[model samples]
Target chain A: MQIYATIAELVSAAETADLSLSELMIQQEVANSGNSRDEVWAGMERNLEAMAAAVKRGSTGEGAFSKTGLTGGEAIKLKNYRATHQSLSGDTMLAAVQNAIATNEVNAAMGIVCATPTAGASGTLPGVLFMLQERLNLTHEQMIRFLFTSGALGMIIANNAMIAGATGGCQAEVGSASGMAAAAAVEIAGGTPEQSAEALAMALSNLLGLVCDPIAGLVELPCVKRNAIGATNALISADMALAGLTNKIPADEVVGAMKKIGEDMPQTLRETGRGGLAATPTGIKMKMRIFGQDRDFE
Target chain B: MVLNYKSVFDIIGPVMIGPSSSHTAGAVAIGHAARKIFHAPATTLTVRYYESFAETHRGHGTDYALVAGVLGLPPADPQVPNALTLAQQQGLAVKFIEMAGPSPIGHPNTAIVTLSNEQRTIEVAGCSIGGGTIEIRRITVDGFELKPSGPLPILLVWGAKDNDQRIQTKLAKMTKIMRQQSYNTAAKHLVEFDLERSLQQHEVDSLQQGAAELVYL
Candidate 1:
């Protein structure tokens, strides 16, 4: 895992090792943990199972409220809406959106979720993976491979730049997860590693400079809904890469750009919940209603 | 690029109950660590959320998560959200204070807590370093600081700086000992060091025989 710090290194290593990104990541995990291949794979399989259960609870349950009373049943509503109406985004995209919403909703409700980097951005990877699972009729092996591939990309971002909003803004959280999902989706869709790398760049470029400002400082509000967009972003980027489109900027440079942008952002735009949507009139009202105090924000 | 060797699972999984991993799971880790190091009964707990944690504590369940951790609840426990009610049930009075504006230093996500019982009080300063990882920056048992209280086994002693040699000798006999810090006052010195492995209960009693207090974790 420490061997490769950037996507360029990852791709080259894949080529040299004559292995796919997922295979290389699995090897690294095996070497690092001194665990048998079966044990590592089974451990990730458990995480996937937990992810699926969260989606089930969020999309099917009568919709529980978060501690803040913000974020809960939107996932179920979207699921119901997709069932009855012709979604403008089409079934697969809509399904991904709902699934993304479901996992984040589960997080908001204090249900268990596997943080794909961080819990605030947990939904994007699972959203993209499960949708591909259903759409491509992927086996458990393929799904686990998707996760490994996603983890590989996330590792690069986490190593070279950041993945937590507190350090890198929403661009680091949902943005990193989206990029990871896009690259993984491309690989599982049988696109070349180069194409997957291109998708990674494209997905990150689409959401660069995004801020992390959850109203009332909760992971509800924008966080859950943003993951839906992240899932869709990954989908389009994967499609673009599969069609041979590429980013002008290299994937690693794009990640570097995101880091710079996040550094330049004011504290309010970070996870302080001080500025952006968190500072909106309605946001302040909600905060007062929930916590009975306005943010001491200037 | 500065490459931090965070595991792929660090990117993928803690499988924690959360709205925000840093605020909830990281906070839980801090409280849990503080309690593990305190290793004593706490009648009252006072927590101060700093900077980013202060602003977003309530929304992220940082409050419940911290209290839950002190109550020995893991981040995955479904009861984390119900921590406040549970605290009341157990008669642990918890106080929370949120401070706005920027943190002067350290990580933006930070929490400082004091857990006090009848005879003693333990103070801990912790930072949630994102991705559900935490840094137990300062763990103080009655002003005795534990330096480098990381994942390593720690043996902290509060006594005379003169006893530092004796304690080192006793510690060396038990395991490999590397002394880290010894902060001394007029009458007492808080000697701190990391141990190769945990010390036995009888060994701890022996170390505390002439010392004011000794905590082993």
Candidate 2:
């Protein structure tokens, strides 16, 4: 796609170049509009809350569980079951995250994922930081510095790619998060933001077009599991960026590409229940057979 | 820029949980995806979180967050708690997993959400990085990876995907025109902005106004 080509050119121009992701983000935000950095950052958080509410509402609607008539305690029990058995390996960062989410610690740690601003993607980074610190003996200051560095790359991805998955897909969602993590890992390991952003860009570009389909409208099956992979990708992308191997695509161009790919996506692919895994026969059968209705087919 | 000398930490807003703006928002996107994917009454669901998501799920209210999404609630809806309850009352099972291992390729905020039926099971893996953005990482039926984003019936409509050819073509030229004109009236659409503004205004009464503004953004 031309979008991909532009992004490749942009990345090439940036490869081996020196720049911080945060700096890039500030530049991107400024380029996008006149909203103050703080204003844009605030908007990011607001969007986060909006996204949160949307998930909750979807579950409560006539999507899932309305047929069996489950209970709160049952929900908790089910949650526990999910916690007990699920495993995907990549790196130590993945391990730490696994421990945290199983324990419910991501939201409290202040991870910082850099949506429109730093506070928006709080869950991913903090969880990774806390896990790394505990397992890797990373210092508090190191964590903070790492965050700053990671935020820099995150900003780049936000500027280059669609940070909002509704605007794109999991490629933008986890891909951007992993980009930040990759950059932060680089920073924590003593790489420059230039290196970090490169790694981040590489990560985003690599993990594009991942979908966002949850069965019965829940964030279970693959939502939480992908975070582990995203974390691991962050580490790997950092390594790739550090090793001096990256697509010659500008982060912004990648963002542009992501937006286009998402546009080409069908409603089912776009988080609307119309495409991807959501449209499968199993998905349809689950809805119809479980709910005792034919609406799934209709 | 003058040296206002705000603390560097001060420059940073409230701390939070993650995936990334894209991942987190992407999770919401997945919720939206689920809403449209099934097109039926989502009755019972099972959510399983992997590595990073498990650790931070609680603070992010990822559990409730996803549930809220399933309920068709907006991200700013304070009724997230009620929605969780409502899910249970309706007989839905939302699960959380901490996948403790590795994978060749994927995001950190991944989840394997299963919406089952008497005869079939649909499993989806969606990642929420940061900013509540979500994307479908992978999907499984009888244990197989399905490229959900590649030939699926779904489509994402936004500023980035407004047209077919141009890059970053969200809403084609509409978003461009809006951005250029600054005429997009999100003031009434987003609730969180109003709530944040109310809080920023330093007025007590206006706080709820901001809170009520949680929707429409």
TM-score of each: 0.85, 0.46
For model 2, give the TM-score of chain B.
0.53
Off by over 4 Å in 1: A1-3, A67-69, A295-298, B1-5, B141-217
Local error of candidate 1 at residue A210 (angstroms): 0.5
Q: Candidate 2 - CAPRI tier?
A: incorrect
Candidate 1: deviation at residue B197, Å? 16
Backbone clash pairs for candidate 1 read none
Q: Model 2 — interface RMS deviation?
A: 13.0
Backbone clash numbers for all candidates listed: 0, 190
Give a tens-digit lDDT track for model 1, residues A196-224.
Answer: 99999999999999999989888988899
Interface RMSD of each: 4.7, 13.0
TM-score of predicted structure 2: 0.46
Global CA lDDT of candidate 2, please?
0.45
Q: Per-residue alpha-carbon lDDT of model 1 for B1-217, expressed as tens digits?
A: 5333345677778889978888998888788877876777788999877777988887788999999899999888889889999999988899887765555336688788899888888888887766786655677765566546443346677776777888888888876664477776666678778654446577778887777777665
